[model samples]
Target: MISPSTSQVIPRAADSASTIKFRDLDRFFLGLLVLWASRAWFYPGDVETQIGVEAPFLFYFTLACQLLGFYGLFRLGPPRIGSALMSQPLLLALIGWGAVSMAWSSAPYNTFGMVRATLLMMMGCVYFRERLSLSDIVQTFAVVTGLVMVGSLIAAVFFNFGRGTGFHVGSWRGLFSHKNGLGEVSAFATLFFASYILAARRAQLWAALFLSVSTVCLIFSGSANALVTVGSGLALMGLAFVTSKLTPSKITNGLIFIVLAAIAIATTFTLVTVVANSLGRDMTFTGRTRIWEIYLRFAAQQPWTGWGWTTASTNEVMTNLVRTTLKLPYLRSPHSAYVGLAVELGYTGAALYVAWLGKTTVSALLGVARRNDKISILRASIAVGMAVFGFFEVSAGVLPCLWLAFLICTEPKKQVGPGKNARA
Candidate 1:
């Protein structure tokens, strides 16, 4: 790990955030390349059979670049790097879980791989934390979404299923193989761009355009979960704006946050059944519900140290749902990270994981509430957006969440005035 430079004084941290630099950008792009290549490379046929370059050589090349990039970043400031990594209790919890998994993981290699990816992504967030403003991140996401939408449009135009009747708009999957993944990505892009618009940056027209394209993409991808996540985020953003007038004392705000969170969780569970029925959506939840049910029962059986990671992908319970139930092919992941962890790691691990996230949520809410500064408030708002996203998506396991969270958590702790922070 590289140390922080001694020349600059770290600002008052609702929390301290690291700046992202050119090297950091390189590392991030390399990481993305490695991930995209892994889909084609890495883990070809069965161990006994030879698969053609199953593992992509590009992964190694990108990995090497990431290492160099990270090293350059670490050299900039040891103190900041170390402090950012160690100070957050939530982060500590994740590390602790990783340590435990290394010792007891059924699929040690897979667990190790996940740990490495998680840590690397987090480090990237720290590196970019200081350099990129929130607006910068938002704008970048908009640009990326625009490119994705363009690609999707081309695919739709070229890959026609019939004359005059092109592919189903709701089922159009762009670069990502899965429609839901596309929906989720577009939804996040929508939220990201909307965040900038709400922050009242000059890119209102661009942001609106991004949101329009992303909305079309979101509807095209047809992911119910994506809809929920994006809708909830927007709702929260609206609530924040509406409630801006009702400013309370810090202690009072914190208490209200706690109360509201508890209420939200409970209400979600109680109303989940009703909402499911009312939507009359697929009972399988596109196969996720079956997985959820299986995991729920399986967790009760062991409740502690799950069946462990399975490379074979044979375990019916691992996949949770059978073909008859969901009509989908055999899947390795349980769809939901939280469900997978609960079934594989048991309640103890799940609790620890939740505790970590809980801490992060609280810290973010506190940062937003306690800080009188405008920049701090924007940071807080982003934190809240992330928290809202977590409710619908089990992001603890996804690379994107790690990157987004790290970015939000590590932003510069500068002071600001209220007018600058207010939503447009």
Candidate 2:
């Protein structure tokens, strides 16, 4: 089993017990509130949006949390949480570009707001460093996921009950106003909780319940993409387990199993969702492929910087061509994150973006494979989930979810067998 780096020591405070707990509770509450009231959290028609307010209250609240976190960073001074997050060469450069990207973002103010939120979540992570167990983190996710499921269920019941829409299959939107948004949240939550469930040592039955409920929500979402991603991720993990069991020697076999599992899961979901439309799904994905082609064609117009941020908004010509040529509806932007980055940031930005992703992916996979510590399996699962979702959701690069991914990747690995990180 791997031990902590000679230089990587976790910081502790004289009276950190209650203080750290408070921070975790605050963070969890903020996240829950946002997820529960996401629609009204910062709506386009809300006061913040109507009065032409540049940044939303949620944005400022997050910024305040970051300020507090920075204070904690310096005040609670000691060995940093993990150098990989702040000192990674490629990732650091990418974050620098991301800061610049915010200036030219389609919604600059919104992007800035989200950045603050992301930082705040990271603060919560650093503050509660060794205070949390694998089970502790998992239960927190389960709680948040439970909230998400309840919200979705409420919205679904509302849409289907006493309405004249004739029981539409795809009209149920939970915290957000769109069914697709609900699908994204459910997919994220499912994978998030599922990783914890798999790594958990005790309470397997409760973990099973969480997975079952999350699965039902994902299916009822009727989001073909979400279903495909979640199903494929599980299948990939299952394969990894099977292969690990088959190996003659389990020592190096476990490491190989972790690496293959991460890659397989990542590749499966990315390919399935990215290609599902081309295989005829009769949905937004059906239009994504066409959108990608059109984005490339326009990007070729100016390969260097391409079109500046919001300046690259899809025009009617490309939208019409795709809809007519491919018989799909008009989608405003490339449905894929990579394509979106290419259209807005140009090749230079796209190259940097991809490099950043590659670096992070490598770091995550390495973090899983090299460490025989606790939560390695969970970290691997999270790395796979991030890669899978990156293909479809633009938020893969943003807060809440991104912060969750960071926790999974950077947390200390428990030196137990695979899928049993948390001892009973």
Candidate 3:
């Protein structure tokens, strides 16, 4: 385990969010990435008369912001490359393999664009880690999610936006176009905020309030996957809080983390099964099994290389194959991130993804056990979320949450001098 660098100040802070430079353009750009991934109200409806912005304009604008955000990162300082890459080797491998796979992508044109966007998003996450302390970062996220929750409440009550489609009708969509999207954000908020409150003794009222409201919104969203993921995350954080009060030695800490991790994993898996069974649902994971079968069939044709990174649900070839092969309505994703990556990136990519996620989660779990800090707990919470949420949604690929959380956790604390952090 790497020693907590005297230079690394912000990694253990669950609170102490002072005034962030809210006017910073790079920060705004990162915020845009979150808003974009959240499927917020800004990008709603058809191409023509789609709110006020045109599709091409929005596309170029987003691209330009990403490019400039990269520049801002360089302007800040060279990243701690050795520490960053060493901490998350599989992540770099995943990206490297993804770039290579574009060469043979069945949807070559589409794949290139998708891969580039993913690369940019990951870069943006690194930039965010450099620019803001974890406390400020989490606080900023809390603020944004709070706004989203408020918007959802208003839309559900005043407007006609709550009665959404699929799985459960009349589910709340909030600021997003769909209830599943709503569940994703709401549950995310609940997970992070609950972890934060657990780690930090102060701000109970606000954090608890936010957590409660987000949990309610998550339930109202009615996505079984989201509900299960959120429940798992909250339960893990609660357990972390309970264990934190004990004064354990380093060896004891490791043992505790291992025990807690095992318990959390087993409990979450069992609860998810129970939750699904209670809903009277089959093992299809809401029609995902058929899609998974189709992808597996296609995958068998090129088990090693896959059709390339662009050949998942959104790929034209995938859509065509699904349409031709299955009588059920077409599916855009295999719905499982692990399987989806395998379809696009093959077994090698899938292995890297799993390895990377494991490292990220384990490292944070260790940190939480050692420090007994809310910030560390929050980190582990997000890591668990990535695995849980990614199981049923193509979240790791399309949503900003997973990568953002990973990059932030793995990023080395910015050093202001030989033995001091920027915050210090």
Candidate 4:
């Protein structure tokens, strides 16, 4: 017979082991939850339809995941709510403004729902940033996106899913409803894997494999916007790398780099315009300019506070007005996050977004100047990528995977004090 002391110790040890196992299982489930909430699969209708009228099943599933994930995070431990809120002041302000817009929203119900979803998503991002290390977050993104790339290939090859649709006949949309969806995700995957490869001291070969797959998907999807986003990311990465090497320290050097970057961006924009004209393409960006023109005209009518957050796509009257004005079939979105923001929340929201971008950019510059580390460079690249992608996509306007990634990747480093561990 065992002694009482030994028997008690055995139960205690078993409990300890069980706790460890539970923690691991919790992490696995949370990762899956993140993937589910990302809306990685193809929506049945036009992309704008997703914003206004998501499929019932998808909507409920995502809602459940978000609720569960938030609960799980709280169970893990009381989050540093103050720290999380302080880290994303402008983002919180933007969401608050969106909430306030519900008062005048054409579709107050929809605005209320979207605002709640956005708030939950932002909270989830904060929890993710708080809980995971930078490397862990990057790896999680890379792995999830790698699965998407692999699944896309399988869907395209065997099931012929998301292919051969009318005007987009030859484009390989894979598991996405549209080619641009596939392209955008693939572009982001490429960036994630690239960051993984750069940061990891080992297992780079695996990261490279995923990187290649993502690149191939990006090419097959045939999205010019995705191509531009990837190019912008690469350019920013290159710039960050160069800045880190040339001036690893000094605020003056960072300022100088910023000036050079501004000049380069202007020159690049001018060259792109010229090149598009030379290639016999209209400067309309495939009729997007017309859409922008019409949207801006509407926005000017409510310069201070527009129709309300997410009204551009959800409000029937607004959608009808835009469609009738443009006389274009299947043109629901403004096709630009900036324009969408201007239309939905007016100039106030637009200014807040600009301020947020400026804050992120400054933080990135400071990070590179201070640390000159791979993570800092990755953050800088993402900041630039978002700024560029926002011009062509509703990247910042909604609670999408891209926005989540931006929140996590560009978050400023937390200060660790005595007896404190940064990673959960």
Candidate 5:
């Protein structure tokens, strides 16, 4: 027999009330919005081609996400007061340059569509910056990734939703539309979880669990590129770790330099030859080299302005080659983000994009160096993961949902420690 006060009714009630706070709801809905609108295997059509039956619905659904996201902002309060955004102008410059390229886009109509989507997504990123804290962003992202893992397991058991065919054979696709897409996201999530674990080193059971699931998905995805991206990210982190530990002693410095040089050479050589041989692939990278060759040759003709937002400078050779040789019904990029950007927007455009990524990465690393917060360290790892992923994939330019997550999470925060009031 417990008395009313002794049972702690008031505290329990307070805790219950806290669970349903506006901010909590805000985080859940915003995370769900990112998932709904981002690149997942949930039956949405590509920005260029409306493939599935639900393509039209998904397109409009994403637009609604924009409106809802704005309303959510209004519900909270006015936008934050600061020039924090102005401090980071490279992202804006990148998107703005993308808009300007429409004038020279080979596919003008498609260019407008793609740019319009990018603008909407850019707004989402801004909303992320204005509203959520860094903790809110990473926790929400981790939660969503956890849901994806559970959903993939269920889908795989009941139907063929997550299984790969053709070259992938018995591999898993998880909830992604393609094996590479699944692998890419899974690998990125691995970096995310790893960063979380490394930063806090406490209550990391959830992050470790997510990391294992993501690694499994990455392996089952059979996306060689995804595997390579994960490896590259690890190598980059290793390099950062070693560099962080270096000393100023002359003998130690000389030894470290020699070791680093040897490692770099071995990594480069093995990445080119040993990796390909082990994977049963050739130097041409399963015809990707040919596809890139064609696109590069065409891009050279219009090096300054190239083509458009979602296409190479000229699709004539690219289209014909895919149709005749590859037998793929639709035209695709050269399977590398850098090459795709160079072909679509020329070297100048690609440089801006790469520069924006580099700036974000450096900012995060600087924050980590300052020990600003665990989230800052997490963002640094994520940026490294994205840099590696960018070499083999394209998301920032094509997919809105996942790219929105990356842009939002990786938005630089100066010094907002692990407290509740931290900045995102």
Candidate 6:
């Protein structure tokens, strides 16, 4: 017995509900894609042996997923792919340089694979930035990483799939191949959940729960580097929040941030020293300085253009050289992102990377000044944290999770006008 207007309104309401359901489904699928790209789950084994080698089934399955993801991203039609690419000119330059290095690479095939992976990962970041709101991206990551943490706990408790070996013996690695991997993921989860709690008015209970779990995981993973990284990041975030309240001027805020950043760096160094001493480690950072010395010597051999992208760890000859030099049978990475980049692409590539980080830091600070949102503050903090973490870990080159997070944080904020979808 409804009137004509009411009948029409009923259908419109139903249609809106249907659209919402479809959007939720779409996001669910995207979350799965994200989990895959992040490598949140991998077979338990020696991480060193797994790198640069993949099972046949996994290789093809991943290839299919990437192809399908690329197709879907384009088909869904992001608003401004060109603009997104343009905004990350330095990233593009870095990728271009990586591709060019294949020409000189002793293992051109390996370099090609590494460059392709980097390009695809970058494209995935662009899609995330252009198609989804920052909040949506953060929420997806939070949920995915939360699940990972929970699964790790279950695996460790039920299946005895937690302990590490060979120097990291007795540490909890959980679902990751190494304790450091778990630590990195846990640190990221903590950051994501903390940011979510600060930004959201509702559903913060879940974020708080996840944050607590992640903090526990971080502690159990026993990665001093991850602990330091997260601590520095949180400190910077706190500073940003404080500065945002104190001033409206971008210049003043920038000055304040610079001062705070310096203090944070000094404090972090002190913490590192204290942690090292308590852990019975020397100033050499458990022989990392010695490794750096050897890496620098190799890098000096090709100061302008190194062996090739990813060759620092992938090429058999380079691996043998490092193993023989370090007198260790197994070695996975240079252990320093900056040194790895310098070894792979030489000083020019390292300079470009530093320049990009500087640019992103400035942009993040400006965003905090302009928006004063938790997301902006988190972005600024993460930019600073990653810059510091790169000194001790291979956070830049091949680590999918860290690199993806970096891309998301560095993306420029979009402007919304009246009559447009604000979140979009």
Q: Candidate 6 regions off by >4 Å?
A: 1-22, 41-44, 47-57, 76-80, 201-203, 248-250, 266-284, 396-399, 402-406, 414-423
In candidate 3, how many Å is residue 82 off?
9.0
lDDT top scorer: 4
Superior by lDDT: candidate 2 or candidate 6: 6
Inter-residue clash pairs, candidate 6: none
Error of 6 at 369 (Å): 5.2
Q: Across residues 199-234, which tens digit of lDDT does each residue of candidate 6 receive?
A: 553566777888888888889898887787787777
State model 5's lDDT. Answer: 0.63
Query: Per-residue CA lDDT of candidate 1, range 281-323, in tens?
Result: 5343454676567557766876776644321133554444543
Q: What is the descending TM-score order?
A: 4, 6, 3, 5, 1, 2
lDDT tens digits by residue: candidate 2, 321-424: 65576654423446666666576667776787567566554444444344423355555555555555656655554335533534432555444575444221
Q: Answer with 1 or 3, whichever has the higher lDDT.
A: 3
| lDDT (0 to 1) per candidate | 0.51, 0.52, 0.66, 0.69, 0.63, 0.69
Candidate 5 vs. true structure, TM-score: 0.78
TM-score of each: 0.70, 0.68, 0.82, 0.87, 0.78, 0.84
Best by TM-score: 4
In model 4, what is the error at residue 398, expressed in angstroms?
Answer: 4.1
lDDT of 3 by residue, 1-424 (tens): 1223422444444433443343255456656666555556545552222234445765766677457435644645546533343445577678778778878887777677766666666666665665555544566666667677877877876777555644446788877766767887887787777777766656668778778878878888878888778776666655655555565575576677679769767876687578878887655457677677888777777777877875786576567778677764435567788888888888888888888777777766677667665556777777777777887877654334533544453444546588666443
TM-score between candidate 4 and the true structure: 0.87
The residue-level lDDT of candidate 6 at 97 comes to 91
